[model samples]
Target: MSESDFTVRSVPMLLSRNKSQEWRDIVLLRSGMLMRFLKTHNLLINVEPFDENGNVKDDLVIKKSHLTDDGLELFKKVIPGWSQYLDKGGDVNNINRLIKGLEKIRNQ
Candidate 1:
């Protein structure tokens, strides 16, 4: 798909009325067929913090990062069309677009 096809819009992420809400740009990475996989699996992107000595911290956090070799392979197998987008550290612009699209879809 072309870049124009991946345009994203901004959306609000709010939790409570008394608290301040965070806003971020959103994009849609996958739709239609891929949605089923997402619904079935509780996949997590694990990130362990490390100190200057390269030792992992005690607290592990769920965070986003570039996919590992195994992760890339699995992702490609699941969504071939989107595999390219995950390469080269992924397209930040397109990711933003995807998030927005997802937000729109969720609201609908």
Candidate 2:
């Protein structure tokens, strides 16, 4: 109803923080309730913790970057300006804007 209602202290967060059944139970219970409130009466804001990437996307995921070194070398012939940013620690996620909708295609 108000901003104060969405504060962390107002939430029923599970105390457990591990890869176990207890954690899974907490997520399942909370996520379901959150969805029902949204779909039924449009009652509450969907502030659930699970993210667009399932709250499990690791940027350092072994193959998260579809751009391989060899691919970049060949791509350099096209957009050479990307190297200036990429070489300076620019994130590939940031470059996805240049990709229109091709970003998801590459990730798969």
Candidate 3:
């Protein structure tokens, strides 16, 4: 996809009413499909929004990095080609499987 195909919109990441954080939200769409695609191909850290109707929205937050040093080594040992994805980001379902994968890599 061309650069236009990937849109990084800057929005305020609020820490609280008085404090905030800065981050970029990357979104990819072609023919109306939104995948969290990153050049680094790392596992994405995602945030989902639930509507008042109890339906989940497509909104997600994609961090630029995935995998801690130990996790990276573990992943590389177990899953070949894991490093490419670690250095990038892509969409995978947000579920227990993902949670478990991240749990292993998360900082202690």
The 0-to-1 C-alpha lDDT of every candidate, in the order given, reads 0.32, 0.35, 0.31
Per-residue CA lDDT of candidate 1, range 6-103, in tens? Answer: 21111111112234322111112222123223323323234323345543332322222323333333343434434356544565334443344344
Per-candidate RMSD, Å? 15.7, 18.8, 14.4
Give me the candidate number with maximum lDDT: 2
Distance from true position, residue 105, model 2, in Å?
47
Backbone clashes for every candidate come to 12, 0, 7
- In candidate 3, position 28 carries an lDDT of 16
Error (Å) of candidate 2 at residue 61 is: 25
lDDT of 2: 0.35
Q: Model 1 clash tally?
A: 12
Q: Candidate 3: what lDDT?
A: 0.31
Query: Which candidate's TM-score is highest?
Result: 2
For model 1, what is the error of residue 3's alpha carbon versus the real structure, in angstroms, after optimal superposition? 24
User: How do all the candidates rank in terms of lDDT, highest first?
Assistant: 2, 1, 3
